[model samples]
Target chain A: MMSVGELLSQFGDKYLQALWTTYGLTVLCFAGALVLGIAITVMRICPIKPLQWFGDFYVQIFRNIPGAALLIVLVYALPYLRVMLSYYMCVLVAVTLIPSSFCSEYLMAGMNTIGAGQIEAARSLGMTFFQIVKNVVLPQALRSTVLQMTNLLVATMLTTALASQVPLNPADLTGIVTYINTHAVGGITAFMISAFFYAVTAVVIGQIGNRIDKKVRILR
Target chain B: MNGAHASIRDVLYDAPGPKAKRRIAFVTVISLLALAALLAAIVRRFYVTGQLDPKYWSIFLRYTTWRFIGRGLLGTLQVAAASSVLAFAAGMLLMMARVCRYRVLNAIATFIIELSRGIPTLLFIYFFFLLAPQFGLQLPSFWRITLPVSISAMGVTAEALRSGVNAVPRGQTEAAVSLGMRSASVFFKIVFPQGFRYVIPTLISEMVIVFKDTTYAYVVNYADLMQNAKVLISNYDALLAVYLVVAVIYIVINYLINKLAATVERRTRAAVAAAK
Candidate 1:
């Protein structure tokens, strides 16, 4: 029957640290996924048949496999090859690769919505392939997929909890929640506090994404 | 300059010339070689460690192993099946609340959906699992996992159903209303069936997610599929082999779900076309 203020005082600093880890992992994974997703999307839509097939294969395999399984495989199996990564790096790589598949699909859908005439118009103006992609296609594609990307960002944030399974880092929010549950008196209240933090962040992210979406639509 | 004549293929790039084809071939060969080398390294490591040994895999032949895995699979299916059913019902209610005329109900539904969507499935499960004892609910272990999973699924299902309902033309509802039918009857008879048909594919996909999410139960010490794998790992110390088996099982199950969903979607589309 601890008061909310007392519960906050008891475990507030550790909870904040855990939240920081969660945020850091989310930002890092989202950035990594964005870069990889762009490359995969480009590969999928490129002129080379093999590259296109490879991109499709990657997405299909990764998307079908459960993220938990993939994380286990990456974290456990890779170490046997003397390619051990830090906990943060392992979580980052796993999260990035898994969600990059979905992000590529979203981006590809966005790219599909760009009319053929837009590309032809760029070509007629003597824009090279890279220039056309960079200056004309990518901006619109990113804008179109902003909402999906935001969803992915929130998902990535949530998925960071899976990193608790990694033995090296037990200080993340999920791990902290587990610890508080075992060690503290008002554990459930602490968990609720943590859940509140995640919900608030998610809502804020959705709002920002909506605002960007609206602005992009207006610019059109 | 009419864009309607050009297709997606035209928007991608120009056709490859002979020189470009040669470059592509060269790049393809190099990439293939790199991939082969990577695979070789992994295989070699496994061979060196004796992870490729038949002895490690022989454990699966044991009846006890089968019993253990079967029990875990059953638990996973039970949680997924129960949660999906509850989630579907909750989603329908949420959708109705959102679409109802009352502003307060709409706002409340929207808030619940957004909050559930924003929170990760893991957190929801954790919150419920912990809070159950505090509130003296005396819920079973399965309910702890099922409740949270259903809450998250409800949010997604509600969104999908709302969009499906929104896609239905307003004229149909208006027509039903003008025919002297009660609004409730019009909703259940006219709006729901058609809207649900439109979202069957999405709902099936969400079920796959719910199935995958049952793995999170491992965190709470629930003996689901992933948790069983963890238990086997502790016993056998064959981490790679156990995880590979677990992953393949998951992939096969998900692939079947996707295949089934695709068939349903095709049939639905065919039925809709016939109706038109």
Candidate 2:
């Protein structure tokens, strides 16, 4: 068994790179999820019945599908359809799709909290449809969902661990741990290092989210 | 829709006037066509790639295939059920520790909860799978998957339980205390039972999560549904069809669980309202 110092000294660079990769994937996937989530939310809340159904269906399919199954489908099954994607792309897409559904659900719950009275008031004020969404709907929804989005961000990071399932050039944090474990007997120390990074990031995100929520929380 | 229960979807737009109604109708038709076109394109791809061939899907008709999958599903259910029970027990203990008078216990509980919640389940599985064996702790493949899945769910379950406990009114505790009940007795007798009722829905949703995590049973070489699907795929030479069916099975099961949670939630809420 290697000492923690020896492991760090030997593979510190790999760990750093892996951590960076994890961060990059988490941020990119989160951005992608937010964009898709907002679009789905728009579709779900739109007056068009078909679009609403599509959005609802999308959420149900993605949200309930296990991450492993979704990733396997993307990585293995898609090639059968002649739609091959890079390993990184498959991981990105899988993580993004799952979290986007959750993102939309949280946004819907946030929007629901705003209640109908506010929308009615906005309508009475002669605000245009776009204006209500822009000025009234989005601000409250986004504000109230800060905590959820934070949790989602952590969840997205955790989901990015699915990257270890596939081969990639520069693997994410979890992948790096697997790399170390396989190449050498990294043991609990290697796992703990990765877990520590995740825990710190989660705590920091939670703290920031609480601060924002405290500041912007709408008192009803 | 009733105003009291109107969600953002219902209230986002006003009751449409003639002009708005016409515009909405036009857009609906356009979107419907767009969705249908998307669906057709997917089916077309499946056709072009020979994925629509009966050879790939015919394996599903065999009774043995379903039995194999059913056996795998039983494995999955067993893991999920075992892990859920373990997680709930640990979670409740963690919750009690956190709310206890001992500061050290509270801090330890909080730290464990945060670490458990923050770290991914795969890492936990790896710890048991790769790390434990290093120290001469050999667990069965089932435990390798089940233990990690349960541990991964523990923090969230603890938080959920704590939330439920908080939702139990302060007056209940005070009243119990006034009746000369010990603090532990008050918590056990008057408080926790109500708290447990309030969080049954949350706990059920947690089960859905645990169920999903069990899919990683493949890593530990456990023959859960996905693993069984792999076996069927190998035998039939149908990877896409088998995996797709397996994925649908998972999604449908999780969906049903979620619906059950929502129903339980509503029923409990109504019960609470009636009591009030």
Pick by TM-score: which candidate is best?
A: 2
lDDT of 2: 0.92
| Chain A TM per candidate, in order of listing | 0.93, 0.97
Instruction: Give the distance in Å from residue A202's predicted Cα in candidate 2 to where it truly belongs.
Output: 1.1
Off by over 4 Å in 1: A121-129, A167-170, A218-220, B1-11, B58-68, B262-276
Q: Candidate 2 — number of clashing residue pairs?
A: 0
What are the candidates' individual DockQ scores?
0.51, 0.75
Clash pairs detected, candidate 2: none
Which tens-of-lDDT digit does each residue in B1-276 have in candidate 2?
A: 112224676688878999999999999999989999999999999999999999999989999999999999999999999999999999999999999999999999999999999999998998898889889999999999999999999999999999999999999999999999999999998889999999999899889889999999999999999999989988999999999999999999999998898888888999999989
lDDT of 2 by residue, A120-160 (tens): 99999999777888899888989999999989999999999
Position A32, candidate 1: lDDT: 89
Best-fitting candidate, scored by lDDT: 2
Report residue A129 deviation for candidate 2 (angstroms).
2.4
